[model samples]
Target: MLLVPATAATIDRRLTGRSPVDGRPALVLLDLDQVQQPADEVADALARFGAGRFADVRQLAPERPEAPDMDGLSLLSDLMPQVQKALDSGDASQRQALKAEVDAVLASMPEAPAGRDQPRLDGVLKAMSEALAAEDEDAKPS
Candidate 1:
């Protein structure tokens, strides 16, 4: 799952292809320091990616309450060598053990909060423009 900044919310809006006639992503204590990400960019990557171009994408917000899928691909980020060794082991028991360990990581993620409803990106863009205008106003000599 991708964790990105709220500013890129527009990109996510388009990717989900949900109704823009809704609202916005709620302002939560979203933690994105672990990865270099932005909201819109996250959606763009997902929407534009194809098989093998990007690893499988499954998002699980730590703020939510549901158990995420126990998929090894999700844990591949930190256990590539172990995962590879397991896949290459060819021994059923070894492979099952490795896969199970990774699966636990997926199952343990904190759930995301009830998501902010989808909405048109126009308001944010307008707000940005207005903020810029205000900045320019402040910069002018009195």
Candidate 2:
């Protein structure tokens, strides 16, 4: 008769390979303040990092929707579609008018600490504004 004491490392290795598990959740630290890219891109990159190296990776912190900056960003998101629709179908004159409204909304946006969606929203709005302005210029009579 042969006998071997059953242990976690043996069981874990048999089940999943790479045993001697630490039993502590591993963490991946990222310093985003230095990333200088839109938040969505950063988030996408993090999400696409398929789990093999580590046990898990997930959103550790959620954006505070109650934050004032979040509220402004939400408002900008709501307003963006209108701007897009106007650009798509409305005449150049209408686009110019909407552009002023966009500028005002942009100017009124309060300065708040960076959040997940804030940079993304800012980038989209700036790009949209620039596109509308360019279109307006092209529409101008020479």
TM-score versus the correct structure, for each prediction: 0.28, 0.44
- Score candidate 1 by lDDT: 0.44
Top-lDDT structure, candidate number: 2
lDDT (C-alpha) at residue 34 in model 1: 51
After superposition, the stretches of candidate 1 with alpha carbons farther than 4 Å from their true spots are 1-77, 116-142
Task: Give one digit per residue, the lDDT tens place, for model 2 in 65-99.
Answer: 66446675777778778778877874887777877
Lowest summed lDDT over 10 consecutive residues: which window, candidate 2? 11-20
* lDDT (10s digit) by residue, model 1, range 1-142: 3223345444423232221123333322234355578756765765677434332233432335336334423434456665556445555566556555545553464443366532223233234334434444555689
lDDT for 87 (candidate 2): 78
Root-mean-square deviation of candidate 2? 14.7
Best by TM-score: 2
Q: Which sections of candidate 2 miss by over 4 Å?
A: 1-74, 112-118
